[model samples]
Target: MTTTAEPPRSPDPGPVERETVPRPSQDEDPADTFEQRKGTRWLEPRLLLQTAKQVAISGVLGQYNDKRELMGGISPGGYLDLGGAGTRDDDGNLWLDYVSDLGDSFEATYSVAALLSRPTLDLAPQEGEATTTRRGRLLVMGGDECYPAASVDEYENRLIGPYRAALPGKEPDAPFLQAVPGNHDWYDGLTAFMRTFCQRRWIGGWRTRQARSYFATRLSDRWWLWGIDIQFDTYLDEAQLAYFTEIARELQPGDAILLCTAKPSWVAATDEDCEAYATLDFLERTVIRPRGAGVRLALTGDRHHYSRYEAADLAQRITAGGGGAYLSATHHLPTSIQVPPPTSRARSKSPSVRYTQGAVYPTPEDSRRLRWGILRLPFTTPAFAGLLGGIYAVLAVALGAALREPARGLPADLRAVDAALRDAGWARLAGGLADSILALLLGLVVVGGAIAFTQDMGRWRGRTVGLLHGLAHLALAVSVIRLAVTLTAEVLAVPAPWSLALVVLLVFVGGGILAAELVAWYLLLADRARLNVNELFAGQAIPDRRNFLRLRLEPDETLTVFPVGLPRVPRGWERRPDWRAGERERFQPADGQLHPFLIEPPIRIPRTPPATGAATSRTDEAHRMDEAQRMDEAHRMDEALPGGMA
Candidate 1:
């Protein structure tokens, strides 16, 4: 095993350690803290509108305001030295953890944080396995620390609060923390992300070190990790490039790199011609390749699930975004992909690398079944249903008014409109809709909005499905109005004022629920076609199957990855009895149902020889031998398991 001396620490001592636990001020009761225990309801009307606005504003600002450029003045060179945390174990192995897309609702977020805060985890190996893994000395938060939008309050409540409560006290040899920014982090131009992470503050017991959003750190003598920030799927800024370029100068011919980014561009590139992958290709070819250093692995967390892809000779691409956000579907994942996609501008004469999909968390079948949960949207997101109801009510009222005779005094006009709706049949309603210009315009808006909402599928297909979805709602609203009018005025024989109130109530409640149900079904069918699949799951806001990666850099230079998954996160928690004793955290799972199992057998990537100063090509015979060895190892692991890995 190769050993390296520990890097020296800064002469200046950092901030004083204090009680980091999130508690109500001295005056408040402790029991009131966990009142809001669920994760972000993505379908909530207010949140949806706020998120849309932030996305729009951030998109515009990203074009003109490059936050990385401003960061250059604050931290001239964007690099951090975390090697002092002592990654090497007694046996000369290095351990590290990678988590991302966390900080949503309290239940899910804290459930994950509590487990990560443990000193070590003794995972019982399946059918044929050997050892237990210890906690990582180096913890890397991939991206999107908080969801919905990046703000001080959101981070404090969703992220820092739970994390602090999980590991409140600062220990002598605490893990060092570093992070990369995702799109959500950029919503506030990275103001909140910077303040929370780059300021070298303590998130629970983990110590922050990076001064810039992007960072490069050496893990061991032969291993390095780079967390790059590509803001909103945009190009990497010049300063970020320069920082890594400088770091590359210190690299030797054979050093291995583990590249981390906010989004999984390789996956995105497989579907469309986008600049995200182009920029990553530029970074690898221009910077790392020139130094003879190869990227052995690529990691990301925007998809909120665990998936691994491997090519014959290229680095493994893994998307493990199951930190603490809503679950995303894995059924639609392509069986294979080509990196530096054919349409990418960065494509070279060399053929694109073919990567085969490997293990995926929640299994594709389970992910498909999970989509059905969206059917409960009406109940889970009442506000969204209310918004739909409000729109239906407005359209019904407009059409009712248009059907009445020429304007009379207010009272007379109301009576005439009510009577017209009461006596109107389906045929009469349809005829009236043609002449109701106000109602016609509102219907058009509904259709247009629905069409715009449909994404991923091609224009024609999306428009067709979106149009059908809108028409279904329009028909439902008309039927609901007619039924409500009949029930109030004819069947019940209610008075004018009471009848009007009952009709409005029926339209809002009945129309809202039916309209929302239409949306749920549309999303479900669209997902079956692999269109708008993200929305299908996001609308559900599932807080289960959360996961993270624990990696061990072995003595022989091989890297083994343990993809840990929490099938169902615990919602209830209680204060730990030993919390005051300083031996345990502030809280533990109340149900004691926090069992984290492996997503699959550990994936081990064998060590490769360092790249030569000049590019070299492998002979057909050599390539065949390498493939055979990998297959033999995989076959052995498969035989050890009860059911073979897919």
Candidate 2:
């Protein structure tokens, strides 16, 4: 035989590349090493991207309809569908019955230009019926019409594109649209929304040189449309305010005023909470409540949902902002939000209703934005906490004798020496590199904490966000954890702030850096892990059978399967397969009666073929095939089980 050339191979391979084995690097510490975990943000990004591409193609031909021309001049030819109706039926079944039964009717979708040109939906169906008779012509409502750093381009993407994609009418730029600025819309000072939709000057494409972009529209002879820019607080100016007040008076007693604002006022947030806009009360006071004023229902959008509420004494306040914004999850329950008792059309205030059996009630106390500094005060804003902290700092220096009698100058026992500097002359170098400075910083921290002790932390709001910042420093001040670290740095003769501030700053700055890394990691890693809970566990672990069922490698270096099987696992080293690879599994023949499914593969039993004479080749092959099939069956059965399987 001729000699064959071959490449040399290493005696051993790396851990990840190996099959039927798991091992650590010989040079690395096995005790401290672990697999790194990661996560991702968007699901179906590819599918969403395709859908977005389709939208781009469909919208490519749209002329940039300016605020001036859109008032009455824009042309229309949009993909209109007045038939796609979807809602849950009485039995909780989804009902997507198209409106083909009714004549051509575009009930919902409306564009900026279209909204500025139309009037009246199919006459509001007979009394008590939810029948919608949408005329292809009517105004569209724009709520917080922009996205991340809401600029003109973002509006074109977040609002205009989606609006066109979701339209229910037949013509583009004909549905007489009304719009309001959302929090995000004003992200860049409401420039996007103002420049795009409120161009008429006076009131939506009208030439009124008003100070604000708020105005009223006449949708029909019997209908009035009003829009308030929640982001533009200055809109409630004297002239506009007067105009609305007068309009409220002129509105007929039976007229249907389509009231719109960025955020719907009916959500559980109290008036104080909704004070971000400072003007939601306009509907109730000016339009709806005025006696003899023909007040219809109010429509608004903000949180990206279609929520309808019957406010006390008022009609339904509908929040239908889902035209193109990010969809809101079913709004967190009645508790996280609250619906005040409905006011009687004739009365003032109503009582609050308790949660019913199947009702949601997330307590406001437990559910306000829990994000770090979600409720913030400006950095310059002085607060009670700061006031108290400042006082305590003064007290610490002044009342030092009263607070604590610990060793001041209590160093690691001091040693002093003098050194001569050719430039500055002789200087007394302390036992350690400036322990005095560390002591002062530490004292500053101590005083900051003392302030928290005096003030009630339970109550805080926007203006007070800055105050607690000083109080938050208490954790750094007198910390045994921090002191040990800071003292060590100073003794090593590290520079001043570096010895003290660096430690403190590292914890915070490092946390911020880590947070940023985590966010970036989240953006890159998770595919099915964007849910909040998963983010909370980001980088925590790639869980496996070793952790849950208590599987462990014994001190003798043998695999120990604990899962209530051949070997019992140690207390914390539980063995539970996490299905990380979505691997197919097989149940142990013996344990099938007990678990019926396994999250991992069963231990392979090394086997030898029957003696040549003991079985025929045909018989042996047949037997092997049968065993393989049984194993596959077991694998299928195991996959049927869920992760929380016991």
Candidate 3:
């Protein structure tokens, strides 16, 4: 029998060795974090149509879906009830459940699990020498573990059932699984989140060991991981503040802290000041910074995309929320953040990262599945306005003609309509009412247009777009006036008062529709420029990728991070080396609801203290080949799956 040579394992140092963990270099420049990429444009026609739908839904549901009160209520407690300690085995490393948006899609969850099963370390491949399957020691869910209101059924179908199917184990796989509640989980008063993640119940093959929403896990004696619950607001409550305050006292000097947040506050910054992510600032001042904790990294997952940003302090912020949710566009980000300049900062030289990924935009297929545009505002506004305008215009013109010559002005077919109005006593009120209505509509158009124009002045690009819309409105107004005076008097002989009313109403509605279109388009443009400033400043569009990170404390205390992307594993890696065709059947779903596993493109991580000359060369050639094989394997998997599984 032939045997393949295996890679040697690194020697394990004792847990007490403190010198092995290196402090972040002060001379490391933040500007050289990631390679600069061009910004993705937000003005695509499909995206514009999608964004209009989002705005309409938001208007009705309000950002948190009218469940803000339930989300805002605090769940008060500390970590003492669950022993407040992380898992410790004799392997000289820690394996964690590092994922976010972990519910809803069965296919995506299974793919990520399969990818994670391939690696034993940040860069090393796990050879199937001992067992066909691999498992982590601990699980750390980033957030949003459930979806669409956190109901019991959502937990069962979206979270528990899919994950159970993905991992495929009956016994306990990990010692503990910790999580923070996300906005969607809070929509149903956190009842399901608490039952599944915070209690002692068994979810799939994973056990819940957290007593509260927040936790502090000791990866080693010197390395720690802290996850804070942000609730619905930007501020932490008193109980949470007190709990962390007490825990900070025990942290040893030189201890590297990995902060896990429910939201990516740094990237969510609306302006240079970063006002939207104020909770992070609050945590920095009150907990991490004041106590002198070495906060090396922060991980988050709310935006449903992957992004990385680094500050002058050597602290890295990552968003890995792409587990199984609709993707968010990077181009719509705010303009304050700048990333990937291709060089280190000249002044601070502190290490920083700036990178983002392209998102899945709404397409023709999505439009067919959901008629979002037709159902929402901005799109529907025009049709509604036109209908109202047509009805009012006809009424006003008919009234004007009937009253003009009172005796013979009525056409034979419309005489009954005039008689009906007269019998109802509305005829007497028509002339004065028509004049008043015309004057009112004319005034509304003038004032509304002026207000909208003034608001766009500060934003030059917005002002330019609005100008086109304004011109359209102007044409409509002119047409309305001319139609009433010339067409009505010369052809229909309608009275001046009622004719003018018809003109005013049509002009007002048409102009308003034009103005609304301008506002919707302008907001989309501004959002794209502002929110994704990182990629724009970098000069390239970020790739479309979903990722989760695994941080392990080596025996020497040096921390290593394995940033894993979904479906990026080698094709045959998931199949047990000893498995026959019959053994593989045991892993398949009983209900025959199997989906062809997808593969992810490998992410290249730069070496520490990145070399300016040989950057992007650090990823080993062998590892690259392993990643390259995933494409062919993906096709094979696709062919293997049953027709209905896809």
Judging by TM-score against the true structure, name the best candidate: 1
Q: Candidate 3 lDDT, tens digit per residue, 1-646?
A: 0011111111332232122222222232211221211212233334335545644553455434433233334332223211112343355545455778766444455445444433243333232122111245556788888654476777776666545433333332233467887766765656678777665555444555555677776555556678887765446765566556555554543466778888876654533333555566566544553333456667888876556654433345667776665444443443234331223223322222343332222222431233222223334345434533553355444444444334444354344333323222233423323344553454345345434433334566545555554444434443443444444445766653454544446444654454445444433343344522221211111222445666555456555545544422112212234433211111332233322121222222211223244332112432244433634443443354333200
Per-residue C-alpha lDDT of model 1 across residues 345-412, encoded as one tens digit per residue: 65452246677898998899999899899999999999999999998888777877888777669887
Candidate rank order under TM-score: 1, 3, 2
Per-residue CA lDDT of candidate 2, range 26-96, in tens? 23221122221111111222423543453354234222322222222221111111111111122222111
RMSD value for candidate 2:
29.6
CA lDDT scores, all candidates in order:
0.77, 0.31, 0.46
lDDT, residue 605, model 1: 68
Give TM per candidate.
0.88, 0.36, 0.51
Question: Model 1 lDDT vs. the true structure?
Answer: 0.77
Q: How does residue 504 of candidate 1 score in lDDT?
A: 82
Evaluation by lDDT, superior candidate among 1 and 3: 1
Of candidate 3, the 10-residue stretch with the lowest lDDT total is 1-10
How many clashing pairs does model 3 include?
22
For model 2, state the Cα shift of residue 369 in Å. Answer: 14
Instruction: Tell me which of candidates 1 and 2 scores higher on TM-score.
Output: 1
